[model samples]
Target chain A: MPDERSADEHLLAERLIQALNLEHLAVGELSPTAALFGHESGGLGLDSIDALEIALMVQKHYGVTLRSEDPDTIAALTSLRSLSAYVLAQRKQ
Target chain B: MPDRAHVINLCAGRLAFMLGFVAAGLRGQTTLLPHSLAARQLEAIRAAYPDCHVLDDSCKSDLQWQDSPRNASLDVDEQATAAILFTSGSTGVPQPHPCTWGSLAALGRLDAQRLTGSRQMNLVVTVPSQHMYGLQTSVLLQLFGDCSVHDGKPFFPADVAAALRAVPAPRALITTPHHLRSCLDAGVALPPLDMVLSATAPLAAELAEKAELLWQTTLLEIYGSTEAGTIGTRRTTSGEPWQLLPGARLDCTADGAVYHASHLPAPLALTDVLDPVSSGSFRLVGRAADQVKIAGKRASLAELNRLLLQVPGVIDGVVFVPENGSRTAALVVAPHLAAAQIVGELAQSMDPAFLPRPVVLLERLPRNELGKLTHTALQEAIR
Candidate 1:
């Protein structure tokens, strides 16, 4: 069978790119360990609204429930790798 | 007892005036306005209703203005009518829209069901308290939604983060597109947001998505005018026809123009150009009155000028028509930017007739506290 979790992560990455109109941003530019939000130079600046929008989209499409009260939501969305890893974990759950 | 039916509306009055309205048999319904009216405006209204008590927003200074939390004692009919506030006129005047407690209350019911699913809401309003959007979403809806209203205005994103951090959980944000955009620019960590509601100026879809992703909340945009109260709301990216509130209508005439009606007082004829999707919904295309007649060519000066403002390095800009029938002149406010260079860039977006020739440069345009511009004020800058 296909690597379902990896496929889901790619699908989500595509959705985020489309949502943000980041067509100029290539898939390779988005590494597993690339920063999603941080003070680092060249980091993709995802503001709070973008964070919320991504969380909502994840919930709406993948059946992942992101509670405002979640302990890991802020941490899980910190980087491309973390988010993909979190989504994979969520799929298992 | 003057039947209470003849009185059109009642709003947030001082504790004393609140008593007078009840004592005189007026239904004391609260509409969302700033905590009070300025002393002069209140005095004029007092003259109009000598028997009715007048609540004045008479603070000694800005320091006092920031400290007051207006509470009222009147137990008027919760369903009584209230005043309508219009967008402040571009002519340096303000417009008032009339609404009723019954109509606003109905909206609260719809919002509460959609938002809270029957639980009470705790609201943290980020917009100024006076405007129609604030009144409907922050104040009146607070009462009808069974929400506890906070007494503060959070401007900077840091301030907003701090307030949300301190407030009780399950807090919702009531704010404007301007304020919301500023927050996103600041890169602050937001406290939990159950629901985020924004109105006043239009909120772009990208920004709305950003907001939802950051807070893990649904960001809903409200569509209505000061005249229409709140007709309907829609999701930012849904692109669906607006679902009208329980009782609302958009009447179209032969000329393809739209008029508005609701459980509101007297029919409101709008200056907008809209394509009605159904009896209840329409897609608004620029306002008809916003069209400028330049040498017999009809053009949207607002959009044209807005494009000028977006030019790289341009901070704030506006093009006001010369009331004396001269061509439209542009006035710009920027930091050490050249007026001549901006005109060169604006040439790409505007026709020669619509182009602002001999652009007037100022460090800042003279706008009122609300950031609204006027033709007269722009003219004064050029002169």
Candidate 2:
């Protein structure tokens, strides 16, 4: 199968796995398009605590701050692909 | 709305929750507040209270407001049940404790005396109104005490900051240790606040000191539970013992400690171990056996182990909190199922916060000739 994840998505996935201490999961197993929050989303099933950790990780790595009140931030957090795009877009500015 | 004995309040907005609660009270209907809004948990609650109405944000559209006479005196029955809050008991079933209107009013008054002290403060609360802590600080305080609440439950650090900024001066932040830690770690610039209140989990002195220094506000940690509302308060940075609220007393017994208050209908036995420092002050030692708190939510280790063993192809398993560890760890002897697979199945019934991390799979659990799993043996297996 072709590698569907972009380079930035792969790097973000690595950081997420490490930051969340998800030793059970590997970088390649994380789907770039999968939902990252809800339990029924058939994704990593991360919760609010995991979201905070991701925000901290993003701030440290890309200098992008994810605010909870922002509608764009909420939309970006829906999936790994969206989060990667949001981070790249923020860094460009 | 059809006549019902109770209303299951699942409203996400604070205003909706308060309105539904007061409307139910006016109709002599009790409001049920479940610990979580998870589908399975709500289903269990609905099964128990089959006749209760489920009130949610969608019901807001159905609300028709009518202006009442100005300064009309609203009479409330003191003995009527106001709300029933659920706590996840050790048996894996949620136990409900009913709070009367009188008791809730007393608790709100006491909380105000200790927390706000006659100040008409605006609160930005991060916890849900369904929980006891949230209900006391956000809803009851606003209704009975001198305070108003922001309508939203802000989750993220930046969101909390924004909410606080939106509120007027003399603002307070009502949150848990988990959210407080996240807010501090995110390093979001927060507006100046009069006070910050924390509960649900024990706040570390260091964290409290840091919060006080950064926010330049007094940080108070409340000690209470679902059964007893706002039993005591402590300035976390002072490292002092908890001062019991007026008219509240703690008595140590052979079985366990029991809390007593004039407002409570009966003396309630406490699940937490307390160290009595004085007649009016005590220090919390820890929770009783089988109860573990993870990220401000309580679950039973025994219940977790039962769920783990109930998984298909699971032979034997034990869920335990490792010494000095906050999260639960599990050792399972299931050859057919992988660790992640077991966790995935467990997640169906358990909250994600209570899910065991680092589930270790072993061929067999170390047991003695007496068929007992000792601490030393379990530690060796995990190691």
**Per-residue alpha-carbon lDDT of model 2 for B206-255, expressed as tens digits?**
88999999999999999888778877899999888999988788999777
* Per-residue alpha-carbon lDDT of candidate 1 for residues B1-383, written as tens digits (9 for 90 to 100): 23332332233222222232233333453332322233333444444445542333321121122222223332446445554343322211233445565666565566665456656666777654445566565555555556666655554455567667777877888887756766676566887888888765556788898989877888877766655656567777677766665556777675655444444556566666666798767776654657564322335667767778788888888876664433567778777666645755665455444556447677787897888887677767766
Error of 2 at B15 (Å): 1.7
Worst 10 residues of 2 chain B by lDDT: B65-74
Kindly list the per-residue Cα lDDT of model 2 for residues A11-51, writing each as its tens digit. Answer: 99999887876656668778888889775556777876787
Please give the distance, in angstroms, between residue A31's alpha carbon in candidate 1 and its true position after superposition: 51
Please identify model 1 stretches exceeding 4 Å from their true place. A1-93, B1-81, B84-87, B114-118, B254-262, B278-280, B287-383
lDDT of 1 at B210: 90
Q: Tell me the TM-score of each prediction against the true structure.
A: 0.51, 0.90
Candidate 1 chain B: worst-modelled 10 consecutive residues by lDDT: B59-68
Model 1 C-alpha lDDT versus the unseen true structure: 0.58
Off by over 4 Å in 2: A1-3, B59-74, B89-93, B312-316, B322-326, B333-336, B362-383
